[model samples]
Target: MTDSSAPPPAPAGPLSGLLVADFSRILAGPYATMLLADLGAEVVKVESPAGDDTRTWMPPVRDEVSTYYLGVNRNKRSVALDLKDAGDLAAARELARRADIMVENFKPGGLRRFGLDYESVSGSNPGIVYASISGFGSGGGASLPGYDLIVQAMSGLMSLTGEPDGPPYRAGISVFDVMTGLHAIIGVLAALHHRAETGRGQHVEVNLLSSALSGMVNHTSAFVAGGVVPMRMGNAHPSLFPYEPLPTADGDLIITAGNDGQFRALCEVLGVPELAGDPRFARTKDRTANREELRPLLVERLKQRPKMEWFHELVAAGVACGPINTVDEGVGFAEELGLDPVVTPGEGDRAVPSVRNPISLSLTPPSYRLPPPALGEHGAEIRAWLAEPTTD
Candidate 1:
């Protein structure tokens, strides 16, 4: 960790002048704050002495530090403050008072008693963008904990996941937590725009349930607008034929023939061009309705080649197709395509690998200024700055 008792240099990105006081731990708030930090905001991560819970979440460790914690905490300074202590509380208050943005993920109204909630902080810095994230809305669900697994189960996501009749499974990643973080980012940016125009800040709120529902776009819309309750189809798309993985000689290859043209091409590739004109499979609706019958004919041809061989043929035919790749293979594929999927966020020996931020700007690209901080690694510097008299 950089152990200097001085503030870091000014950021050079689009959000260079912004200061974010981050009173969040775990995934959602930390993820949003990390993105802000990448955009050149100065982020001060406030934590209790025990530190972020993810610090102890292990099994995957890099240099003995929790990878889970490191993954979302780059480009930030850490300050450990026990809120129960008057001096620490004062320092936290000072940090919040000086910040232009504040983000927290405590349960609804959890920070009110500590005077760190939106109302309290905005009372002094009226232009601060205050963002709060929760699992459910702060309305009737305020008492529930904001666990991603619970949100996945409650948000109807798990219902749509898994093998058709098998037990529902949570996603390999905390999908809703990630979605909530992205939503929080959107809310904060919008609030910043509003503040720039009106010279006033407003509270920005995001919750996991709402983000999850919004993310289930096609599924939810099918029920609401079309009165169709969708169920798991075990990797099959409900409306499109040949949209699921098909067996090859060696493995499975996902093949999507989305239109009549693609269907004709696929039929040609299969050496059964006449099948494209067969009345039973002539159109999308007909193909979908006769999928059970059409499946075996396509399967018989696909089983003649290996997955990657079939993958190339299908792609060349202007049909979308690929073999499902493992995470390592996926990253390798991105690298092969010049996407540069991984990056190191710090200078010299301490640098660590990070997923490249997805956004691309013609100018003002995101930067990697700081490596993930160790627990209170910048405590001395942060506390010293917080002790100084505040102009705000």
Candidate 2:
């Protein structure tokens, strides 16, 4: 007979039936694992006795819980263990051996002493898709700490942010860490595909600095391929005229013209179609090079209308523009567009409002069965599960 009190099985998803041992903390590793958990992987988050560091990153809290911690950690179970303790170390190792995937963000050699490193874990769990996140590669930079702000500075991202005359500033969020996490996920998925065919697994490594350079895209390309180091131009694009926010009657509205057609369309909407054929602004390169001369002409027309009126008219006329929005306004805009950006996970009082995962799968979609857990919330149950003898 079935045990009526037993928990119901996890709802089906694309990654259903997969077990992921997540031994990572903070942004990058936790963010990747949380996404995997959302996709229906059975994620077991192994935390130290003190729990993930973000747990204490308070001030913006929900029910006195850290919203920062809550932001990236959902749909996973937590099991706290002190690797210094023999029993906890055994449990962690056992979980790794049984896991189909394992993720960690320890220093390059930090996990070696605990026997939780890829070499040791993969020896027993040959099919494990092991992912390691670091601030830098496991080269000379390995000795250096891997913080997102540090990466933003060292990777030249800060150099491209802020105004030309202002000091370099890090992005508002941990962008490189998030990018590294995404890169780690791509690596894990690819390695999993390879393992399915070959029945062997490999180590996947991602670092913040590398991900930052890659994420910077065109700016990095400008330097490497063109030997031109891109610099901060405030809200302006280095290669496009009328791409930055311009003054309106009441406020500012961002405008962009990536091609001749868009520039023509913009000029038409501004009731200055003659400017489209002006020798100083007819072509994209010419407009970019002569932006200073072209700016006053466009601004004169833009300043005649309120930003919202211009927003509707420009959008209707097939020109791209929008008002600068706060985060709440951004979410409201998505909601107004029927995007359904927010979701509440868990049940009853434990339910926490979170941003919905951005992916859309027609077949097996993401399922949120658990909220971000309290410290060691699943310790007993997970420990019992790991202690059981495996038939494999």
Candidate 3:
């Protein structure tokens, strides 16, 4: 919302001179470009004539704009183009031809018909780092549509998200989509570095299913390496005892004792120091194996105090524990720790509050140059820029 009529001056940061042509929509692609934009990339978000679908995902709105769209579309310019239209498609290809980077989450090979796939675009702009995201890989699973929920279910994440005896559940958020976006960013950065070294660029592909499997980490490893299929254990950790929430007088407090030392510390704080030396709970492996017996003993002491009191006391004793927090409380907790979790982009009237990027770089920190844009907010200017001859 920084008056789209006048482009904001570029900030001094990493990726300052990079031009990103964002042809992606929904969550994964847009989220990646937004982070690139934050890191000082000049991201031009190309949208269909009706705009990105998230623009209408409302009921959670700010100034009548969908917060869902705003959450991942800041610090970027917007251009509406109909890929089916000859004129607009030409303009889009022109944007791609001049971009240093390009990101899209269209179905596998979906952009081929429009001549915007990696092969076609890289043919014209050999240095362009093109990224493609999909639900699955481009080979056998090419035709399958990419959606986070489907990936969660297919990747076995949903099966491990609910209570042991209850039905499966998808995660509370599109975690795999976000993870894929982060992976896409990582791929683009690596490709850019390779381009700098070799004077050539390559296609970087990411899929939700693959990202999901990677994100599953230990759960996926349990099956492949240990021949053990992980199951839903509710709040429990499969390998570590005391790694989940325990009942307190008022509520549950998450406590994690990953090693024997932390377990000893936890026991000391709970006023059950003797439990740490007990044969059944003396070692990390022992505690994990005897968790059914150990859990009730720890819970007995935890229930003697309110969660917050226990939180302060246990944390002070070097035990990892805290009350489960809601989203708002999580932000407040970050604020209380002086992390400044939120940032507002744009100046006055149109400024929108957003979560700060998690990264912190001393030399070139992320910048918030613009708030999210209105549909086609910078179309005229972007089109004019695309019409100019490439300098590189």
What TM-score against the true fold does each predicted structure earn?
A: 0.95, 0.97, 0.97
Q: Rate the local accuracy (lDDT) of all candidates.
A: 0.90, 0.91, 0.92
lDDT order, best first, reads 3, 2, 1
How do the residues 1-392 of candidate 3 rate in per-residue lDDT, one tens digit apiece?
23444436655879898999999999999999999999989899999989999999997999999999999999999999999999999999999998999999898999999999999999999999999999999999999988899999999998899899999999999999999999999999999999999989999999999999999999999999999999999988999998998999999989999789998998888888899899999998899999999999998998998999998987898988888899999999999999999999887887899999888989999998889989998988888877877667
Off by over 4 Å in 3: 1-10
Between prediction 1 and prediction 2, the one with superior TM-score is: 2
Candidate 2, residues 140-240: lDDT per residue as tens digits?
88889999999999999999999999999999999999999999999999999999899999999999988998999999999999999999999999888
Error of 3 at 145 (Å): 1.2
lDDT tens readout by residue for model 1, 1-392: 23553335544888988999999999999999999988888899999999999999996998898889989999899989998898999889888889889999999999898899999999988999999999898999999998999999998988888899898888999989999999999999999999999999889999999998899999989998999888888888888999999998999899998999999999999899999999999999999999999999999999998998878887898989988899999999999999998988776667879888888766888888778998888889888877777554
Model 3, residue pairs in steric clash: 135-146
